[model samples]
Target: MTVWDRPEPPARPVPLDRERIVAAAIALADEGGLEAVSLRKVAARLNAGPMRLYGYISAKQELFDLMTDEVYAEILPEERPCEWREALRVLAHRTRRAALRHEWLADLLGGRPSLGPNGLAVTEAKLAALHGLADIDTVLRAVETVSSYATGAIRREIASRRAERATGLSERDWQRASGAHVTRMLATGRFPALASAVHDGADVDAETTFATGLEWVLDAVAARLTRPPA
Candidate 1:
């Protein structure tokens, strides 16, 4: 065929790269949870053959790692706080917010080591926040403690949200009226403390509950810290 009759080489397939591949995978996961993401589906979204993705990612786990790191980028603050307490608090809150935005994140938050650039940057920020306050071991422990709390809390919050959506009721309402059996059990004198808390406790929103618990943990960390002399 003549040059004029050629099909223009199909536009170079839009220049596939790791970023585009990860973005497509993340979008798929966001829409349908982590189960929805696969190399074939990601390839289909990018209009490329499945084998073409192998150049950028060897397996699905690597794709997940990339997606997690990308979310970490979102978790990183534009301006981190200088004080250790506020800085740790910001990391926890921002991470929770990011998980809320990407519900699938709850599944993978602490599932694996985050060795990507953005993920390492987040770790660095947390460590830097407590740099001079204590020894390296103490600082590492503090960071781990805060991170563990944030991860567990985020997962629980997301699970609660999903339960709420599934049951068409708020968590408080669900707890209050789970069933006749639960009501009867609560009424029994055998579990007075549990019953009292169920009946008398304030039904706070999820944010309030998470914040209160986080502050309590931070307070515990503060108690353990060996603050340098002023």
Candidate 2:
């Protein structure tokens, strides 16, 4: 005897595309932070299943790479600025803003294996910024120095932000927290430079500190480039 009727298959609409998935992931990150972003969450946001997302992105790392590139691509290189110094300043500030928007960015960029278009684009842009330098070796060194400083500075800034948010305190609170330790160290009279530096308000305005350090880095690069052949 034949079956009375065959059940009809469910109609499968066009599933979420990569761009849509990535967009949802970024929004999730913005709302709840990177920790809140997961394949399942992204899929849930799109009304799909976690396994469906895996088809478009092989792993969580890929998702992270895309998210990072999404953030990185927002920074625009300066166009014919007065000097490389100004260009570098703009690029540095732009990158700092990107990192601030997504605090986990520094940790991702610093240690992750290169994984996507945006990541490569950022590296390529930085390399291109040093294009006119005299030597490839020098250019490479400059890139290393600038990139290292950017990553480390961004990471520290993220930490400081998180600390402030969690403790409901500002840099002033940080100074207060360390006051005892600092005072005791000063009282010992063994570390003159450290004591004097702290007493003089060494860690003051963050913007000024960032710019000063970046300028110092640029100066060091220029010094190396102009040094006599050895």
Candidate 3:
């Protein structure tokens, strides 16, 4: 056919799937935090019309679920730790690491039931580690409690890091600036306990702090396991 008579080649559309949609959302989140992600933006990133994403995910919430599950896949270690304490400890640390990698995770951590397959698998691993080691009630409580600590701790860590990045100062430096005002408050002598803590507390490593707190929580759980019933 002559060049003028030739039909234009069919336009190639970007492939659309849940994984690609979720990846686009994650890239947006990683670049600008969770608040930056949107269905329209994600669709644009994949070079598809916004309505195209509705086929894979119905709402923004579903997209959040997918993002969370992606993080869960990263949190689950290939080699499961054998002992219950070690397994739980490793699970908590891995989760914290995942939050570090994907700061948006801290916002959604334990905020809702993780119904995704990988999320369910993560829950199963935690329960399996404690199965037969404790009563069902204790096992459930143990899993929930450990998750609570990890989630709360991770949120705090991410907040601190974001603040550090914004201000270009570690928490200690931020505190020192606040300490100036605190020192003035101390002179008023109305806040003795706050004064003592502020003056006496040492700023320690975050990893060490998180590890120590997890061990303390685990120790408490162990006590419950061994304690005699009334």
Highest TM-score among the candidates is held by which one?
3
**Residues 2-111, candidate 1, lDDT per residue (tens digit)?**
21122322225567878788999999988889999999999999999998887677779888888989999998999989888999999899999999999999999776
Candidate lDDT scores, in order, read 0.86, 0.75, 0.86
Assess candidate 1 and give its lDDT.
Answer: 0.86
In model 3, the runs with Cα more than 4 Å from the true position are 1-13
Tell me how far the alpha carbon of residue 8 in candidate 3 is from the true structure, in angstroms, after superposition: 29
lDDT of 3 by residue, 161-198 (tens): 99999999877788787877878889999999887887
How displaced is residue 48 in candidate 2, in Å?
Answer: 1.4
How far off is model 1, as Cα RMSD? 7.3
Q: How many backbone clashes does candidate 2 have?
A: 0
In model 1, the Cα lDDT at residue 120 comes to: 85
- lDDT (0-100) at residue 207 of candidate 1? 90
What value does the lDDT take at residue 176 in candidate 1? 61
TM-score of each: 0.89, 0.84, 0.90
How many Å off is the CA of 174 in candidate 1? 2.4
